[model samples]
Target chain A: MPDTPFIDDGSNVPLSELRWPDDDLTRIPDWIYTSDEVFQRERERIFFGESWCFVALEAEIPEPGSFKRSYVGDVPVIVTRDEDGDIHVFENRCAHRGAEFCRALRGKAENFTCPYHQWMYDLKGKLMAVPFRRGDHGEGGMPKDFKLEDHNPKSLNVTTRHGVVFASFSESVESLEEYLGPENLEQFDVVFKGRKLKILGFYKNRLQGNWKLYHENLKDPYHATLLHVYLATFRLMVAGQKSAMICDESGRHSTMASAKDDNIEIGEETASQMKSAFREGMELNDPDFLNYVQEFDSPWTVTMQIIWPNLVVQRELNTLGIRHIVPRGPHALDMYWTMFGYEDDTPELERQRMKQGNLMGPSGYLGVDDNEAIKYLQDGFKHSHSQEGIVKLEPEKEGSTETLISEASVRALYRHYRQVMDI
Target chain B: MASTHPAGTNLSPEEARALRFEIEEFNTEYARILDEQDIDFWPDFFTADGFYRVTAKENHDEGLPVGLVWCDGRPMMQDRAAAVKTTMVHAPRYLRHYNSNVRVTGVDTDGTIHSESNYLVIETLMEQESRIFQAGLYIDQFVREDGVLRLKARDCIYDSLLIPNDMVYPV
Candidate 1:
């Protein structure tokens, strides 16, 4: 038999190999996490190919001329609002030699001038001036053929909903509403609630693993009550909690809604009986730290909403934020998390949110635990080169299930991945 | 880390030499404890009501209040130590913190010493070469109690915007 190449850059790896074994959405191959070819295909077909990717919150560029540079996959783009108070997104590349036009993380400017060649562009990405367009003297001017109108930077179809900005490179992509679907749209609204978002600050980190691993980590809900001892020990979540894994019809987005097993009296009794996660007689050193006042009409104590391609709007017990993903390559990616709240929030509420924020970020009490687990997950795939792995936890039906111990949401992500990549 | 009577960031020749030696020794000891992973004694380095926070310089410059790790008192710091010791699971790594350029900026009349120093933490994972993990300025406020120096506040403002993997221990 021909020696099967266990390790490949994914060029020679056949498209047939991309298909899940036995056509099972629950089965994921290791190669998907390791293939550069797969990453490029995803960039082309998923990111640049007909998807509304989250760029910036409307609040980030609230004023006219205010702009923030963001990424859709690996392609950097500028999100700016013009003097007309309309949001627009375009490639940050300069028209002349493709250097980045907007270099700052954020700033306000009447227009942008590329440092490389002094190619000036209006706030809306219209080419306005060129350094040598008219030349030193009229005698050296061009043949009167270089039209500035023809050389404007490439722009995208952009929209702002509930102070969240989304841009799509493909004009043919569905409206942001249709793309998010009704389920995700409802959850998004629940988080945004028409309140103006405030850019509190950002927590950024680079994970030395596949970008999908983060998604997989969120979709894999079973690991939560096991790994994050803080959650289980506090009865914030447990296997017996009344939870649900909600996947959209498109299978591209998902929301995990978990109501604190509310029966904590009984939950704690059961937990105290358990040996590993729930130890007995543990109390918060500062009970004030758990001073959460539910501001939402929703019942879920913790809601992690995953928008297709790149956005995660999170509400972890009054701590609200968005997690944005940028794929560095197949093996690594960056996560920029912006923690925020409403502008009119009370001082006490803001303090509560800030204190509660400790449960998240690269060093969060609960968040760091997931990183370690995902690192372990990536380590497993780096060596195991398995053709297909099992995910059939509560796999009776795939879209949404009323259980926390299910990998159906992860399967939902891959289902959309297969359709978009045409595997 | 603390310093005694490094008044107004100026001193006589003898006092300057003595203060420099004291502050340098204080920093060296602080770094050594963390590097040696004597986490139990970590909180004792701080005053009873001291504050500790680790935030990115980006956030600090923007005046953002959130931190990767924010502890309000020695109790909270000790709780963090306990959590890191018993609860957290981290891959085996050796961490060594280097503190340099200790500058005592000012001294309050109440014996609170204000100092700043540059720090670099080198981490070596099992079977991996050591890498510069974090480089930042230790913006500190120190106070003395019963002639013993203790940290009043430590703001570890990390300049590197991107945190690698996860943070298992305090900076």
Candidate 2:
């Protein structure tokens, strides 16, 4: 008999059929963005394997019994705070018939009862009771020894740092601090420094592109100079600014940091290079929208951290938020944006934050450009006969660089991606 | 047209009908300008200190202060209009606004009118079918400037939770 390959899902294409176009880190094959086999493997190896995916913020479910619907990969999960004030993460599927019982996006619940079969579960995801377990006056009761504990829904290993929540499917996943190494942790702490967070609101939008494109967009500072006119015109981030793309040793996480310079003038050569982005007479009618209140101790005015696979922590001047990427398929993804502020922020600061929010989200001055570019990339890959997309700018470098003309962070991401996917 | 009616006096049946007709005419012109893609003139529909915000129904219900498109004054709106017109890059599309159920909820002592209207926006991208983009309620406060109704505040609370890609233009 022939040796059968392991195929967990019946619809997934075999892994042997997919191939990388070349071994070079500068060239990315289009199949990685359009293959179902690769997507399934990524789900198995990265999102569901040894990765601590960010699920929710502690401020979202601040009180006992407060629950929010979230996702680990594409699978649905529930993040809850029990009566003991301990956080728990469990699959939303009912243990009896595999029904997604918790329907609301978020709410406070004492206990969950599956509407299909009436199987009840506690806040900790323990099976508390079952309707008609004795089956109508003992006519047809449960078999001899059925244990309530055995039928509990599958739960995950939950951990939190500062106020951010993360969940993992692996039992022996490393500590959150160790996962985000010392260098990455230093930048992470700049935003989450033990102060209470007050969530302002949310912005949800669906993009017609793969989920990883978002990470690439943040990592590739090459695009920030030419693509976003608002960033370039307003001098929020330009080519000659003090910027660094800091990637961790594992290459899975990165922080693209840049400081704003009000007095810096664009040189002739640099101005010629960014002709489309930098306008000569462009000025804001409301200059207060560009006000940068110095709140953080860090020197960087913008620190966009891509925390591997699923989360993006955004600190763009005074505006602060976290973007949770949920992959729908190979070609589509949904972004859930949670815009927040600190509890001690004054009314003026809050209003400032709100005004500066025009630079972000789906309809933002800078954000819309990226979304359109990603969509165009996806359309090109899907419709054309191109086999590979080039990422060869500053080709000699790999992890981090000081120049804005490099794709070192993007190349670093692919290097890590190739190892994990075993391509 | 001078009248014997006091500032806080209730309008007669004929007066209420005339006021509704005038407000509807204003809304029709507003929609026509937006649908025609004359965005430079969009800010002129509001007073100098008018406020405009577009937020989800969920956030409005929860009393969340954030807005998808938050403009505190006409200057901010003008800035947004300029960005969307000249700087921001987005796919070209056409949007048509359909507003109905215009109701004059109340009238203040200073002749400021508070009204509500249901709105629907249908969008058509290049070489794509026209689809419903957003459906919402416009909670508005209008005050006359030189006998012309100008929006003092327009709060667009959308029912669609997940916006498709981007909403480049104002609602």
Q: Which stretches of candidate 1 lie over 4 Å from their true place?
A: A1-18, A138-143, A261-275, B1-17
Each model's TM-score? 0.93, 0.95
Would you list the clashing residue pairs of candidate 2? Answer: none
Instruction: Give a tens-digit lDDT track for model 2, residues A176-279.
Output: 99999887899999999867999999889989788899989999999999998888888998999999998888888999999999988989898899988888
Tens-place lDDT digits, model 2, residues B1-171:
365442443675566667778889988999998899899999999999999999989889999989889999999999999999988999899999998888776788998988788999999988567889999999999999998999999999999888888889999
Q: What C-alpha RMSD separates each model from the true structure?
A: 4.0, 5.1
Model 1 Cα lDDT, one tens digit per residue, A155-222: 99888788888988897988888888888888888988767777778888888688888888778778
- Report DockQ per prediction, comma-separated: 0.51, 0.49
The top-ranked prediction according to DockQ is 1
Position B3, candidate 1: lDDT: 49
* All candidates: interface RMSD: 3.4, 4.7
Candidate 1 lDDT score at position A332: 76
Consecutive 10-residue window with the lowest summed lDDT within model 1 chain A: A1-10
